[model samples]
Target: MKLDILAIGAHPDDVELGCSGTLISEARRGKKVGIVDLTQGELGTRGTVETRYAEAAEAGRIIGVSVRENLKMRDGFFVNDEAHQLQLIRVLRRYRPDIVIGNILEDRHPDHGRAGNLIYDACFLSGLKQIKTAEDDGSEQEKWRPRYLFQYIQDRFYEPDLIVDVSHVWEERMASIKAYTTQFHSPAGTEGDATYISSPEFMEAVIARARLLGKRIGVPFAEGFLSKKNIGISSLDALVLQET
Candidate 1:
């Protein structure tokens, strides 16, 4: 199916952690959205790849995305090479999404930056007529370049070029994130070594960041994003702003 947006991340929960609120809000408006996880997050400290796949499926259900596909690339080892770009190009052409959401350009985790650059390149390459790719059904795919590519804000702070107000759907977004039981802060789960994001504080910080972004735009909550291209709007009145 043709998608309005395809959100890509380096790992299973990356989209959820970064842009799930925006995804959920857009899907509620009848937008067809999909997710492409570059890796299954096999290298995470807490959950196995099998468990992460299951949890990612649950997260997809919560966000109401039409589909979620994994590239099965090596966790933490995947590089921005020709092979990786070709795999992403195939999906990009197959979906023919109008927009693509990707990981932060730079983040605490190296994989996030690599995936961001890889996707950025693939999106551009997908539009090249000379580049060839095939669908799963073995049919030759047509070239498709998304109209917009966005970078979701992650661990590190960067001034966002765009902020999406997600106040109406914030709770649903949080629920979608909580669906990743094995990855996030779950007191009931089996005790294991805690990582940077496994702690309750990390979740709190994510929420806090949303609030800050929301406050900047006079909303209850929002998600921040950076864009490689300068954003344009038709009118100043269309922009949400803090009331004086």
Candidate 2:
């Protein structure tokens, strides 16, 4: 399906933690959105792959995405090699999204940074026409490259080229994150042992990060993104003016 936006994450909840609110706000505005998870998050200490798959589906429904696909790459070992790039390219051709949102360039988790670079390279390669891919039917796939490859800020802070005001979808965004009950922290008891992400503090920090980014635009909450390419705005009125 042709998607307006395709969000990719190294693991199940990466998209939710990074850009789910913005995605939800966009989807609620009638934009077609999709998600591609690079792995099942099997290397994680808490939840199993089976549970992560279920949680991811639940989160996708909450975000109202057109599709939620998993590449099934090794969670912690996936590399940015030719094979991996071709696999990602195939998905890009099939989805043909205008905007591709990827993980943070560099983060606390090494996988996040690797994934960010991997998607960045795959995006360029996908547009090369010569880098061939095929559809499910084994037919030739058209070369497709997303116009914007945005890297969402995750564990580490980086100056963002743009910020998406997601104040309206804050509640729904939190719900989506919470949907990954197995991976995220919950006040209620779960089957697995506690991890860094499973702590109440981490959840609070996530909200705090949104608030911090929102403050830049005088919004209640927002999602920040970094892009190496110049971001074009239609007019000056489109920008958020600073207050004295």
Candidate 3:
């Protein structure tokens, strides 16, 4: 099915942690949104791959996305090569999304940075008619590239070029993030060693980060995004203006 937006992440919960709120809001408006995880997050310290997959599915339901898929690339070793680009291109052409939500251009995790660049390169290559790709059904794919690509902030913070107000759906977004019980702080239970993100403090920080972004725009909660190119605005009234 054609998608309005495809949110991609390096690992299972990356999209949830970064852009799930925005995705949730958009989907509630009846937009066709989906997710593409570059890896199954097999290299994570806590959760098993099987558990991550289950959690990702649950999160997709909570966020109300139409589709959620995994590329099954190597957890920590995937690189931005021709093979990787081709794989991504196939999906891009199949979905033909207008906008793509990608990982931060640079982040604390090396994989995040790599995945961001890989997505950027793939999006461009996917639009090239010369780059041939095929669908799962063996049909030749057409060239497709999203018109806009926005990078979500995670781990370390960067001043966002845009902040999406998610006040109306903040609690629901939290529920979606909480769907990954094995990955994040859970009231239910815990197994194995505690990782950085698995701690309660980390979850609190997540809420705090959203609130901080919201404060910048006088909203209760928000998600921040970065754009390499200047965004176009039709009118000043359409822009969210903060009172000085």
Candidate 3: tens digits of C-alpha lDDT, residues 99-209: 999998888999999999999999999999998889778899999989999999999899999899999999889988998888888876457798889889999999999
Instruction: Tell how far residue 69 is off in model 1, in angstroms.
Output: 1.0
lDDT of each: 0.92, 0.92, 0.92
lDDT of 1: 0.92
TM-score for each predicted model, relative to the true structure: 0.96, 0.97, 0.97
Model 2: per-residue Cα lDDT over 139-205, one tens digit each: 9998988999999999989989999889999999999999888777776526578898888899999
In candidate 3, which residue pairs clash?
Answer: none
lDDT of 1 by residue, 1-244 (tens): 9999999999999999889999999999999999999998988988788888888998899999999999999999999999999999999998999999999878999999999999999999999999988887889999999999999998999999999999999888998888877777876554689888888999999999999999888888999999988788899988665785
In model 2, the runs with Cα more than 4 Å from the true position are: 189-191, 240-244
Clash number for model 1?
0
